[model samples]
Structures are given as structure tokens and as C-alpha cells.
Target: MFLSMSFRLRTEVEALNMVEAMGAYSRHRTVSLLKPRGDGKGYRLVIAPAVSGQAIAFGYMKSLVELAQQKNLPICDQCRNYESKGGFVKHGTDTSGDLENLVRSCIVEDVTGFMIAKAEVRRTSAIQFSYMTPDIDSSDVAIDPQFHVRAAKPGEKPQPFQVESGTAIYVLGVALDIDKIGVVPDSNGKPKIVVANRAERVKTAIQAIAHLLEGLSFGAKKARYLPVYDVVGAVAAISHPVPFMVSPARISKDMDYVTKTVLRASNYVKLFSDAKETIKLFYMDKENVVGEVKAENIDITKADNVSELVLKIIEVIEKSLRD
Candidate 1:
């Protein structure tokens, strides 16, 4: 099973992710992209603040470690200590030279993947994250430097610094291959399940995703500048036998992205009509930001919040596992 999701986040006065501090100014990560001009003539370049995929992935891994520990799943010493700066685990020394031992012994390594530089053995991660960036179609995106100062003594000068803060409707996309957890490819390049409790591991993986989004757990600088954020809207797609990516919410502000993604998924499903390929969609529209969505052929589930939506998806996954 392959799961893809896209969500809209509204953050105000947030310095969630930042680059190196240059002098007294701390810079927020920004990217330049070409956007269609309102005149319908040409495209213009827009520089927008963004949160890196690395940052988001790190946060997700942290949540994964916590959930795995709660279930008494094995985690390497390095990952348990939250070492290597980004929740990276050390490669296990498998004396038998079989990489399967490495994955079977540690849930973190199995899900996030790792590379043995000396041996040149690498495992691709089952989960993927896209950079959290402002919606290109929205006109309310803005980033500016906020000035701050440290407390001064009776006769001492104040220490002042600048940090970039942003306000925008940001979009984030994530994908996970549920079948890959606790499974490794064999020497013949065929998938092999190395762990015995595959269902438990898969459910934990899904739960970690819920913990990450619902808790708003990703990003940095929460000690001082915690961004006021809300999940404005979201859409998720689940497919079997073939990978299907949902359309991102950043495409346009005028159209409902949820309906658009369902239509696209419906078309994709028809391509494999003779096969067992199937897709299911779920969406949540808070504050009526997405308005009404219109589609047919497939049923779309609606949830009142993020937790409820994830629970519905988990039910489908559990049923698939039983089959």
C-alpha cells in the first residue's frame, strides 16, 4: 500500500526554520520560484520562506522513535539517544554479512533507511517529505525580520538581534510505502519480510504520522517564536498495487484541491481497470477554506479533524493487512 497526503498550514509570525545567523541577523530558509503573473502574459519570480525536508524528516523520526519505544520495538543505541543530530541510527555490525539483520534488529533503521559508507550498502527510506513552503497561488505570503533585544543592566547596553518571521498559507506533501516497513530487498531484488510482527510495525508507522501532524511537531525555535498555526485543509490518497501521488494543495487558490485530486486518482484507477488496483480518498476542510468539492465514481470520506482522518485511513490499512 502507498499513501500520499497534502495539507495546508496557516502560520503567523513564525520563525520555525532558520538558516545560519549572519552577524546579528538570522535568516529563514527561502526559495525562488516562477509564478504565473496575474496579467496572464508571463511568469514572475517569487522568493518565499520555506522549511526544509530534512527538518521535517528529523521531526518525524523523533516521533517514530518515541512510538517504537512505547511498543517495546527495538531501536539502536544511537537512535534511542537521539544522536547523530538528525535521529540517524548507526549501522549495525552484522557478522554474517546479511543486511536483513540490520533491519530486523532496529525499527528506526528499517523505516528511515541508512547507508554504510564503507561497505557501500544502502537502504532507501520508505517515507518521503517535501519542503514546507508557501502556496504559490496565495497572495498573503510574506516574510520579514523581527527585531529583539536582550535585557540590559543598569549601565549596560542592550543586546539586539534580528530573526526572520513569516506568515503564509504553506503546503506540505508526504508519502509512505506501507509495504516496505520491516521488509528488505533480497539479493535477487525481491522484497522479503524480515520482521515477524509486520502489522504492529506498520500500525506504529501510521501512528507516528498522526503524532507529527496533529502535534505540529516539526520545525525549530519553539522556545521563543512558536508560530500560531492551524491546519486549514488537507487531502489524502491511498492506492494498492501501484503508487499514486495526490495533487499538491499549492496548485491554485480558486479551485478545491480535494476534488481535483480525487478526479486525478479516478483517472489513474481506470488505467488499471483490468487489475486489482484501487484507491480511496479522505479530506478535511476546516473553516470552510476549501468550499464545496464535486466529484463522482469513487466515494470520498470527510473527517472533522486530523486525528479522525488518520484513524479512518488506519482502518483501511488494517483491513488491507488482514486480506
Candidate 2:
């Protein structure tokens, strides 16, 4: 099974992901993209603050650690400690020459994948994350620096610093290959199910995603710069045998992302007639942000919140596994 998700995150005064610190100034990650001009004549470059995919993946792995513990699944010591300095997992040297043992020992490594330099072995992660960036089609994105001074002791000079904060309707896209969890390709490139409890691991992976979004868990510097955010809207799709991605949400003149995704998926389903019965789409439109949409060949269910949307999808996935 393949699962794809896209959601709009509205964060204000957030220093979620930071890059290198120049002197006393901490920089927030930013990216430049070409957007259509208002005059419809040409495209203009826009620089917007962003949260890196690595940072987001770390947050998801944290959730995976916690959930795996609760479900009594396998996890490595390095991941259990929630290490963030060098990398999320222990270095590949620790698990050299044995892909089965590496996956068998840690659920995070199995799902997120790892590379062993000395052994020349690499396992591609089953889950993928796109940078949390502002929607190119929207104009309601801005990032600014906030200045602060460290408190001074008696007769001591105060230290000043600057940190960048961003507020925008950010877009996040995530994809997970459910069939890859607890399964690894062997020496001869044949896929093998390494873990005995593959189904539970798959469910745990899905729940971890729900946990990440429900708690708004991804980001940094929450102690002082907690963001005021909301899941304005989202769309998710599940398809078997063939992968399908829903259109990402955007705040353009016409906010019909949900409709567009459904139409696109409908066309895809028609083209792949065998997958028509196995494909499903779910969406949540808070405050009626996404107006009515009409499509065919697939059913679009409206969920109350992130949890409900994920739960409904989980049901479908679980059923597919049984078949």
C-alpha cells in the first residue's frame, strides 16, 4: 500500500528550523522559488522561510520511537535517546555487513533506512518528506528577524542576538510505502520480510504520522518561540499496486486543491482501471476553507480533524492488508 498526504500549516512567530549561526545571529532556513506575477505576464522570484525535511523527519522518528515503545516493537538505543546532533540513527558502522540484523534490531532504521559506508550498503527510506515551505501561489507569506538581549548579571554587559521567525500558510507533503516497513531487500535483491510482526509495524508507522500532525510535533526552539499554528486543510490518498499523490493545498485565488486532487486521482484511476476499487481519498476542510467539490470513480470522505482522517484511512489500509 502507498499513502500520500498534503496539508497546510499556518505558523506565526515560529523559529521551527534554524540553520548556521553567524556570530550572534541565528538564521532560519529559506528558499527561493519562481511564482507567477500578478499581471500574468512573467514570473517573479520569492524568498520564503522553510523547515527542512531532515528536521521534519527527525520529529517523525521521535514519534516512531515513542510509539514503538508503547507497542513493544524493536528500536535502537541511539534512536531511543532521540539523538539530534550527528544524525537520527547510529552510524552505519555499528550495523555493518548485516542488513537483516540492522533492520531486525531497530524499527526506525527499517522504516527510515540508513547507509553503511564501509560495507557499501544502503537502504532507502520507506517514508519521504517534502520541505515545509510556503505555497508559491499565495501572497500571505513573510519572515522577519526578532532581536533579543541576554540578561546581564551585576556589572556584566548584556549579549544581543537575532533570530528569524516566519508566519505563512506552509505546505507539507509526506509519502510512505507501507509494504516496505519490516521488509528488506536481500543480497540477491529479493525482497524479504525480516520482521515477524509486519502488520503491527505498519500500523505503528501510520499512527506515528497521526501523532506528529495531531501534536504539531515537528519544529525547534519551542521553549521560547512556540508557533501559533493550525491545520487549515488537508488531503490524503491511498492506492494499491500503483502509487497516487493528492494535489498539495495552496491559498491561491481559487482554493480548490481538494477538488483538483480528486479529479486528478479520478483520471488516474480511470487510466489504471484495475486500481479503481482500491483507491480512496480523504479530506478535511476546517471552516469551509475548501468549498464543495465534485468528482467520480472515487469516494472523498470529509473528516472532522487530523485524527479522524488518519483513523479512517487506517481502517482501509488494515482491510487491504487482510486481503
Measured by TM-score, the strongest candidate is 2
lDDT of 1 by residue, 1-323 (tens): 99999988888888878898456789989988678898888999999988999988888888988898898998877788875544564553332334688788888788888877666677889999999988878646888999999798899999898999888888899999998998887789899999999888888888888888778678889898888988878899889888889888764645678868877888888888777678889998885756565556556799988888889999999888988
Question: What is candidate 1's local distance difference test score?
Answer: 0.83
Q: lDDT values of the candidates? A: 0.83, 0.84
Clashes of each: 0, 0
Please provide the root mean square deviation of candidate 1 (C-alpha atoms, Å).
2.4
Per-model TM-score versus the true fold: 0.92, 0.93
**150-259 per-residue lDDT for model 2 (tens digits):** 89999999989999899888889999999888888777988899998888888889899888877867888999998998887889999877998889887567557897
**Predicted model with the maximum lDDT:** 2
Off by over 4 Å in 2: 84-87, 186-188, 274-277
Off by over 4 Å in 1: 83-89, 92-98, 152-156, 251-254, 289-296
